[model samples]
Target: MSDTTNDTDAAGEGTATSDGDADRPTTSVEGAGEPAELDGLAVDEAVERVRAREPDRDPETVRAALGFVAEDGVVSRDALRESLKLTSKVLTTAETRVELAGIALDDAREAAESVPDLPTVEARLEDFAAEVAAVENRAAALGEDLQAVVDDRADPAARFAVADGLRQVDERAREVQRTADEIQFDLEAFERWLDSHAVRVRDLGEDLDALAASLDDLATAVDAIEAASTGDAVETAAGEAGGNAAADSDAGVDDPARAWFDATCSHRATGLTVADLRAELGDLRTWADREGADPVGEGGLDDLAARLDDLDGRHGALGERLDAAAEPEWTDRFGEAVAAVESDLADCAPPVDWGVVQSTVEEHRADIGSDA
Candidate 1:
């Protein structure tokens, strides 16, 4: 056998024992030794290349082949050859595992980055809500103060001052409303953009909740301001001024200014008067003349004109009663006259009875003269 033991010894040391030492074959395996050496070199090179490619790669998996060699008992050249081949296979698998783990880590990081910080967004929204509430509360308080001023039983000058203040507050409230509308528009636009971006519901909810709360506060503020600056308050103040002027007139103090003021105010309030009636009659006559219509006769016109004349005659009698009582019933008489004139004008047909109308006017004038 050409010294088979010597050839086996020359191949390398530490080969695994056969099933029985006495029956062991002592010979060098040619192809076996060559493949093991090549495998070991390939494994070493692969480990180095992987480490270079991924600087942050886990050292444990890469060092797994080396650790296997050091532990698990002594290995012969034949055994070492087997180890190297097995280690190379294991290193290849470890590299694949490391690559997969790296991919997984990258995907996890991207997912984390894409998510919004919901807590931070919620905190910001809460802060905005607080600010809006504060503004609304202040506006409401100002409106209440305005209402108190309007309700106060004050003099004309004082009432006028309060009214002016109320006007200013109303203007300010309108400005606030405008601002709130603008902010709401902006919020809607932002929400639409967020929707397009497919933002998370939890985050969008936080923002929308704040905005809705703000809108509610703004609405409350507007209601309060409107309540304070109501037309009723203005009218009440005007009524008080008129009553004072009337009181002054009834005191037998013939102040022309007071009389005019009382007359104007009472007429506005009650819609009455003799002068108002005369003016209405004049307007009706002008209208009839312009439209080429009769003040009486045919259709509903005759009935309406007769009714109006009767009403005017009744009003002239009432004026005599007011004069006898020495009460200023001008407001009441004016209202009756205006109604009569309006009714007559509304019922006037073509070919108005100008003669009857003229005669009726002279009779009313004579009655008014006698009453005066």
Candidate 2:
């Protein structure tokens, strides 16, 4: 799972000419990730590095590490440097061929200009086009190969023994990149559709339906939560006193899915209490501990929402109880508690269902899943 982070990058960022906010596409929210540093690496080696160490890094950063370059889109700097590095000899040979082809092309063009024969001109033009297309195709192939290592690793632990830590790092980085790409695609597609399609002006029925569904789900979640939180005799037996209250959860119960969601999701402005988050986590543990329950199924959306509601409640309560007057003191206390949990969770690498977590509550949070 990831942490919450803020990004100031937006659409038409470097290309913005107008001062109006309307013309610019901007997204600002903190999500878990760091910019990847992948300069001065051979293509294969750099890609390996990305897989092994990029799990916690941002998608954009992962792309950077993959030799995607700072520029984006079809003609971007993606894999260009790495391709050159990895296939310098081949590129050198290709360049020599291209230079020779260019000389031939220029000679043919001069002859065609001087002679003005239709057949000769057509032949020369075809040859020139063929040569240019060949070189472009070669360059494209080289770039694709360089990117493959970064983006196309085998499944996790499939080659774990063979790859050691390198494959894992690459996989993590690739995943982040994929997520970023998907978000950009979805948002741009939606924007395009909305702009072009003017099917209706207003639709209250859909909104009402959504609200009704949300309320019904919320009620079910409340009931499920109450049922799950009754007690935990096993947790008590696991040492509720002395052995570290934080150390009592079952193995695989301390995943970062929810934490990542909270840290990354939208509408976050203040402190969400550690104790309350723990309470929700405690409930999650209870669900996991339930006999024959779907531990990995993640329960119904309502159950998930109940925990989220608790998270928001604690967040609101904390905001009300501690205003901006005592910022420094509260920051220190909150930081310590969070840091402690982070440090502890670091030791427990629980499996996460990232897809479910990202999409579950994401329907209501506008563009939260996308880099937008």
Instruction: Predict model 2's lDDT versus the native.
Output: 0.35
C-alpha TM-scores of all predictions: 0.21, 0.20
* Model 2 alpha-carbon drift over 4 Å, by segment: 1-162, 196-210, 221-372
lDDT of 1 at 160: 21
Residue-level lDDT tens digits of model 1 in 5-101:
1233322334325343333323222233211121223344534543554457555554443233222432223433343334333333333333343
After TM-score superposition, the amount by which residue 331's alpha carbon in candidate 1 deviates from its true location, in angstroms, is 82
Q: Whole-model lDDT for model 1 versus the true structure?
A: 0.37
Alpha-carbon shift of residue 137 in model 2 (angstroms): 29
Error of 1 at 109 (Å): 28
Across 150-174, the per-residue lDDT of candidate 2 in tens digits comes to 3322211111121222233334434
Q: What RMSD does each model have against the real structure?
A: 40.6, 26.3
Residue-pair clash count for candidate 1:
14
lDDT (CA) per prediction: 0.37, 0.35
